[model samples]
Target: MQASEVDYLIIGAGSAGSVLAGRLSEDPGTQVTLIEAGPADRSVLIHCPAGLALMAKSRQLNWGFETVPQPGLNGRRGYQPRGKVLGGSSSINAMIYMRGHRADYDAWAAEGNAGWSYEEVLPYFKRSEHNERGADAFHGTGGPLNVMDLRSPNPFGPRFVEAAKEAGFAANPDFNGAEQEGVGLYQVTHKNGERCSAAKAYLTPNLGRPNLQVRTGALVTRIVLEGRRAVGVELLEGGQTVTLRARREVLLCAGAFQSPQLLMLSGIGPADELRRHGIAVRHELPGVGAHLHDHPDVVLVYDLPGATDLFGLSLAGAARVWRGIGEWRRQRSGMLTTNFAEAGGFIKSDAAEPIPDLQLHFVIGKLVDHGRKTVFGHGFSCHVCVLRPRSRGSLRLASADPRAAPLIDPAFLQDPDDLRRMVLGFKQMRDILNRPALARFGGRELPASASARSDAEIETFIRNHADTIYHPVGTCRMGTGALDVVDTTLRVRGIEGLRVVDASVMPSVVGGNTNAPVIMIAEKAADLIRAQA
Candidate 1:
């Protein structure tokens, strides 16, 4: 096979990969190539904020992987959706621009990941953001990624916050500000009412740069390693195998599942596991896919009568949407501009906890089973999840073929403590939903949550209903421990010319939505790579 060469070979042109590709190619001396398994982010569903409401199940834009019957979830296979488009999940997520909590990063620093403390990493976050709120000590203004308040939030969003107030929580206008604990409307990564995915912000504008080459529909089969160092990647494009060598480094930004799956497929994981999968071990990194975890969430849905803000499939709803299209075309603001989870916040279930352990997502629609299960009529929903789950899982090779999906076992709610916490959080969500501020909407709870009042009943409801809130991380965790895959600098511990820069590198999942953190990681990784160069 003829081999092509570039200064940097980045696998997966998603959130992190997009940023890395754009940043590394800034220097004319650096040649960077980014490979994505999915197509370009050109579909309307990718750019429209309302498209996120249904984008979770779009096969063209989502890598719809299912878990192997989570034991913690009563033997039900949980749905795992990662972005298959150029922007990765950022293209399909509810654009909530959250950086998690400060304590989350400090804990990483405490875990031996120097320079990852909240204070150290804040600059990278500010550097990537162009908050519409203007420049401040906590925010930046001229950055690529546009962060703005919703121009057309559902009227129900404020009612959700009002309900929180009635339930005794303070109204916090900014969850990303001085504190995170309270009710508030979420800031979104949007520009002029359009989704501002990482690809749009970092990659699209730099497409003309001669130093950058982006390849879509490239399914990477394996990383080509010379002994313990990654040299390049072997990818299948249009049924043809191609080898692309990196003269400098091969970076993996394939997110949690694929990053470790690629590592294991390339013989860089546990010796025994690789052997079982009929692969020769080149390196025995036991933690390649060992620390997988995600937020375990449960949705409390309610039926709302005469709700014009929430999305629906009825004739009246469709008519309103049809009219909304014209309104959006004219003014760039309308119901079409809604990111359904418009308002949410962080809360501490226990006063003794140092930071908020629970998060709420107040959706403007009645979401069930990640919206996979269709619920008729007009309604709204609220999601409550454990911000930092104690349970961890694994991702392993199900087959030797790289084309095959990896065995994903998120092990949701495996820790009894997580279940206990979910029960507590569920009560808090119910209390807020029951407040008089929302009572006038005339909604009733679904059966699963309607009668579950006691702790035991709530626990049963949790085990049956809890699933992923879309954030899966830590499979290729960064730290100095024996099981750590990468060090503080994000370089593979036992390998050279390789580094993992994505959500997988997080030693622990942050306390909020992960897109912002993933971008921040790539921003920081770019600096680290340039400093060495």
Candidate 2:
């Protein structure tokens, strides 16, 4: 395609981009082009549920970005594996379908972002989902995104829930149900036991439409701006610089880190920062990459000697998985259907908290260093994260080149209260894992957790191990404040024909998994853009 006129040219065919392209192209009059930096999402490791462990260590399907050394993390760099495929992180991530707490969106409205309250946005959430358990007032049927219960979860998941009950937490069947205050197995974003990523749900189904064009291996260099308005984009594809003009809009759906990086590279960020990088400034948006944050999580690993149900590295474990693969291929159910973080919950760090301050994920395998490191033997791990962290960080330009990674500083555990909450949440996890119900399944705690006894010891342990649970948001925050980057309409405040409709525009990070919320955001954004047309 030459320098063509695209009615809506969307950057990054990830979670939000896929939704926008699919929805905006519904009208035959509207021509949409969705560009993705990564290749196609055809790898079997992506579709298989249990393949997440191997995907985590391999950079084949991900950006494999890492942070600058974080002071709060005891001067250790944290791993950030963003999906470099059509589905974005949703393709490579654990397929847990979570929509976070309702109060998270309500809080966005409280901060002057209208149409973002829980009540206002619930319809979009409902519209984007087709839950396997059937739809009700809170859920909708016949949607693009497929939400379902895991095909065949390990038995250890139920045991963890039982342990939670024994530890005094209630057993809530659905975390995304009426109330999110108990422990249970998680429903996944899967269809027929295969991963149903955002791209698969929204993009792939609509690819045959004449108005929609999907391009892969397209790296957007910068937004093509004339004076103060973004009219198109310049992308490096096929070893050539290609310019595609957007007749109506240039929608940016890049995730948290790259969205801001693109804006900064396009000369729409802080003036001094752009000038120092030797990039010409077109518009100065101070909050382009500010307010970066994620759910800082700590994992507690245990060495269960008599484990038979958990995934491990031994010969017996490989044999079990090998047999399970055949079962999954035949019946679409077995151990291979595990999402690893199969069971999870939402709970308060303290009883005085208004809503759940901490979220729990009980993995059926030992996850050390985001599963990048090899922890031999059979065991289970529990992850605890602060739902709402007070700490904030930023993403800045690492180099003038567009291909270079950004300077990601999540500033984890910077706030004293965040550390305090994490310490408290750690105790909660240890209690649940050591409960009488799980005593038969429990063994000696891992070395790092075992050494941490007092509150101070726990804090030290957290500082040494806490990293992102992969839910990063609030970089190009949406609001009306001085530092706000986008408005409630999802449009960049100072730029015309440009809008941001990804997790980056979130005013704050939601309390649970971010994939579902991002799909919901794009679902509403499509309506907002079309309403004006």
Candidate 3:
């Protein structure tokens, strides 16, 4: 077996890992090794924004993980598509650059995660973004990641924004700015119509650096710990077990599910569970897989009255594709370059709350069931999700074998409050879609047979169809609490030279898309690690 050493050994070359590798190696004094379980991000589909749906189920780019049957979801198994490439979900996501609500970060600070407040972390957010609108108090001027508004948004996008207003909502041009209370087109992480994945933003530019080593297809099996100190990692490379030692730290950027599973597999989780799995104890931390949460999304699909949808352009619909391609190629502007969930808003389910709790992602095309092998046409969809869910789930070691996947139970809609709020969210969607503004084009599709007036029917529909919008967090929470897997600085509890730099450390999930936040965490974690060094 080949053995190597690095100053920083980063596991999982995802959003966070890419940033860490790029930032840490900039000094030219630190040697960083980034190991990715998946292959390189070289697919053309990954660059095309609309092509995300086509890659959702592709095993080459996705982990293709499914959740265990949940009782709350009526014994139905949920689908989870995690990114498996260098850029991670950022390479696969819709590219929406939402930073979530201000309160979301303040809640983290209030919960003992110091320096995580909205005010404190705002600079980091700005430091990573290169907005098309240029520099401002809220947006950064020169950064690696390009944040821009859609050049030529979908034809229905503006109508969706107007429809929200007809339903009594404000039109917000920036959700990441002062407020997140209204409907508008979302800012995306793209540069001239191409995806600005973390790898592109942070890694690619610095790939020639001698200090940075990015090894794809390196699947880390376990953290090599000695007396509560992580010294290195054990990985499988080319069918051979290899050992890579880290002199300074071994950071886990393996995401929420994989991070906790690795911790438990390393014997750092619940003692009893470790004993049951026949794994030797490294640390007796009880929160490796606790406080799991995910945003459950319910899609409201509607059939359009005319042929105004993107789905009508099949292989036979080559004219539309040709026109779209020409428009984009000629001027870097077109409907094909934008994420069709072009317009959306945030609203409070209850009147008492100061901030909005429900987030709506409106799409210009019909999307049914993970967009995999489903028939779609000239239709549209409105996905309403509760941003902050009270329901919690867990990820546990099914066995001690490193090759085995962990058992994930997201426990969606387990709490009645979650169901009630989601029902209200659906009601909000229906109200917005039924407005005269949208009625000119779209008609009700799903839940049409059931009376839209009844809360019971809405709740029933949610349980039957609500799936994860792919935002999972809080499994390995960071805080000063007893159950925290890592501290406020993201250092793993009861372990030295080990830190978790990913969405898994989020004490609570943010109110919007998590890719940008994850990247910000990496930026901050890199500074912290550098300071310590």
Candidate 4:
């Protein structure tokens, strides 16, 4: 059957897809269609900032993906939960608004990605943010997405900031501002204590537009290619197969994992791999699933010495929770409205470096294995992760069928340098916790014994406990290199009318949270597409 054609057919209403749809559809003459495999963003758990942990393991709103067994990780498979909802991972994430280091972006431009330098992309970051702090040279006030500080943070949040300072890190009020080399409370994508997911910021308000059509539960099977050009997509909707066409362009925004998977399924990947799977090759892009990277983090849980933690919720604590819920249901404030990863910072493992090499997240409660169950009483957890890992991995086709999940091999810690960096990162985390400022509030739960001091012990800890901090990128890297899947303009290397505008195109993983950067990429891509129009 013939299908309806739109000006822009956006596959995946994720962080980038939503923003692209909203921006491109602003001109009434352009028609945009955004397809998402998941359902709508109607879950209360998604909006409640404190409820992020509960949604982490929920398959209802997440694509509960696990990696192929890794030899370096003692043959253990790691859990990778990505958002399958309207806003994608942004809906279920901790909402930290970090842009990483300026050096990270400059490195991308240095690698032939011309317009991605820190100076060039900073305006896009500012243009997309409606910071509560008001308009400045570094922040935008009338943007779609809202960026604000936590309404009220955990008591330990302030203490963590002081601890970081005592450990020799400067107090940086904004990681996305003038500098990123410090420790302090993180700003989040929130407005008046509610989540400002891309769906909320871009899709929700624009739902009334006549030119925009958003279809949930549309699982794209493959791109509908007319020779080497992508014209649209074939998808499954309500147990029926449907083919949709795009008159102008077909943008893939399915993120780091699925974007490459979709490309491979559409015969736009390595020639040898496609032939191995008995699929015809339309383009021989060998880098479709190469250069996969993620930030792996290890959690150090410690028992608090007093009742100043969130775990100490007695009847008074229950009262506080209830009161906060009431306030959130009414005016949107209090504890219920904050993403509990209240404070965090970046630090250099080696002081001689120009930027930080490690990232930290300070939580006021104990969370073992994605907070499956709450521990009783007061406890704290500091997650230490290497900002830049030397190890690299890839995504590959398990089968030619698009319905089959792609094989993910993160190859974490395969490089000895990664292990060394993780050791230093953990040691730095220990230094912060041992500082006099934090020592007054908590004692060591995990002591730094001889095992903690040994290289073998640290390596074992990393292999056994390290999991994704939820930042994954570089599967379909953008550059002018021979192995690059996309060029600097986000257009596919060998295909026309096909662009990848998501985390998949990151030439290298940014040092901090990826949501803000992903949104900035979409904001930039929108302008590029408009210029083409």
lDDT of all predictions:
0.91, 0.91, 0.87, 0.87
* Candidates in descending TM-score order: 2, 1, 3, 4
| Per-residue lDDT of candidate 4, residues 363-428 (tens digit) | 877767777656655677899888888889999999988777789988888888777888888888
Question: C-alpha displacement of 527 in model 3, angstroms?
Answer: 0.7
RMSD of each: 1.4, 1.0, 1.8, 2.1
Candidate 4 worst ten-residue window by lDDT: 442-451
**Cα shift from native, residue 177, model 1 (Å):** 1.6
User: In candidate 2, which residue pairs clash?
Assistant: none
Per-residue lDDT for 467 in model 3? Answer: 89
The alpha-carbon lDDT assigned to residue 309 of candidate 1 equals 66
Q: Compared with the true structure, what per-residue lDDT tens digits does model 3 show for residues 281-375?
A: 88899989998899989988887645554444355445676787777767767767878778899988888878999999988777788787576
Name model 3 segments beyond 4 Å from true. Answer: 1-3, 313-318, 325-332, 447-452
* Stretch of 10 with least lDDT, candidate 3: 309-318
Pairs with steric clashes in candidate 1:
none
Q: Supply the TM-score for candidate 4.
A: 0.96
Give a tens-digit lDDT track for model 1, residues 1-533.
12389889999988899999989999998899999999999998877788877786688899999999988988999999999989998988989999999999999999899999999999999999999988888888888899999998888889999999998889998887888899999999999988999999999999998888999999999999998788999999999999999999999999999999999999999898999989999999999999899999999999886686688767788889999888887888998888899998888787788889999999998898888877777888999999999999999989989989999998898889999888888998998998998988788998878988889888888888889998999989999989999998899988999999999999999999999999999999999999988
